[model samples]
Target: MDAPPDIHSLLAVLDRDEWFSSCASDLKLALVRDARLLRCLAGEAVYRDGESARHALFCVVEGAVRFSSALHDGSPSLLVYLEPCHWFGDISLIDGSPYIRDAIADVDSQILCIPMQSFTQWLDQNPKHWRDIARLSTNKLRVAYQVIGEPGALHHRLARRLWLMAHGFGSRMQNPSLQLSVSQEHLAQMMGSTRQSINAALARLEGLGLLVQGYRSIELCNLENLVNHANRLGGE
Candidate 1:
C-alpha cells in the first residue's frame, strides 16, 4: 500500500473534489491548509457506528470505502459504497451526533481529513458553503429513492444493485470492469437478501458471462450486458 499523500497533492484533490470545488476561495484554501492525509489498508475501519464522530470529515482521495449500519444486536448491513471525491461524517461534524454507520476501507485507500474545528470555523465564516453540503445530501437521497423503487424479481434487483455499484463507485482499474471490494455476505446485506440468494444471483450472472467472481471481490465482465439488464429494470 502507498503512504499518505503530501499536503500539495492533497490540496489538488480537495480542489478537484465535487463536494468542495465550489467552496469560496478562502474556505477552500483553509481546508487544504488544515487538512491531513491518512492511508488505510483494506478492511480497516475508518470509523464505527455509535462512536463519537471526532475524526472530523474524510474525503476519499484513492480507492473505495463502504458504509454500513447495524441493529441493536450488532448485526450490520451495507448502507453505501463511497468512491474518490465522495465524503463521509460531515453530518456528525455539523450536528454533534454520533455517526449512524461505519466507514471501512474497501481497498487500500488514501483519505484527507479535516478537523471538525477547522471545518466548522471555515463554514461559519462562509455560511453560504452550507448549500454545497445540502446539495450533496439531496443528491444522495435522490439516488436512494431511485434505487429503492418497488422491489421486483431477485435477478432484476441484483442486477440493478450491481450496476449501481459498478458505476457509482469509482476505480483505478484500466479496464471497464469494476472490482467490488466486498464479499457476498456484505452484498447480501446491501441487497436485503440472504447469502444463499446473493450467491445464486452471482452464479447466474457468471453463467451468463456478465461477471467474474473472485475471492472477496467481484468483477463485471460484460458492462453492456449488465447495463442492459439493469436498464430493463429501471433508470438510474
Candidate 2:
C-alpha cells in the first residue's frame, strides 16, 4: 500500500514542471488554492471521448493517464501516457469544445482538478494570463506533432518513444527518472505496430545495452545512446 500524496510533494513536482516552474507565485497560488485532488483507480475513465464539455483544468500528480481514441470501426487507439506534473484538458478548456480524446487512468492515480468557473472569473479580470493557459495546450501540441511526424524504422521509432517517455515528452524535468511504466502492448498501440514487432525491437534495444525490459515497464539504460541510435538509424 502506497501513501497518499501531500501538498508539499505536489508543489515539489509542480516546481519541476516546465510551465508551472515559470509561473508567478500569485499565479501558482491562484491555480492551486481552489483545486481539489481526485483519486482514480486503475482502468477508470477520467473523461471519455465526445463527451459534453465539463470545463476544468487537470494536472496529474501521481501514476499515469492514457490518452486514447477510437478508430472508424470503433476500435480503441492508445495515443500516449502522461505522467506526474503533466497538465491536460487544456485543448477543450481553451476552445470551449468537447474533449476529443478519452483520458483514462492507466493506474491508480491522484489528479488535481481546478474548475473552469474559478479560472473563468479570474481570467475575466486577468485576460493576459490566458496566454499561460495556451502555453499548456501548445506545448502538448508540439509533442504531438513530433510523435506523428517521427520517421524511421520500427526500431528507431521505438527508441525515440522510449527516450521521449523517459523525459516526459520534452517537458524537461529537473530530474527525470529513466523508468517507464508501460507494457509492450501499450507501446505497440502508441507506435502503430504489432506487439510481436515491438517485442523484437525491445530485444534489439536490450542487446545494444540501451534499455532493459521488465514486466509492464522499461528502464532506459542509456538515454544518449538511445537517442543517437534513433537519429542514426531513423532515416531523414
Candidate 2: worst-modelled 10 consecutive residues by lDDT: 1-10
List model 1 lDDT by residue over 15-44, tens digit each. 555446656666666665667677899989
lDDT of 2 at 159: 92
* Model 2 lDDT per residue over 154-208, tens place: 8998898888888887566456768999998889888887899999999988998
Write down the lDDT of every candidate, Cα atoms only. 0.72, 0.82
Clashes of each: 0, 0
Which parts of model 1 are misplaced by more than 4 Å?
A: 1-5, 11-27, 41-43, 72-74, 106-108, 169-177, 222-224, 233-236
Backbone clashes counted, model 1: 0
Best by TM-score: 2
Would you estimate the TM-scores of all the predictions?
A: 0.78, 0.92
Alpha carbon RMSD to native, model 1: 4.3
Please estimate how well model 1 matches the true structure, expressed as its whole-model Cα lDDT: 0.72
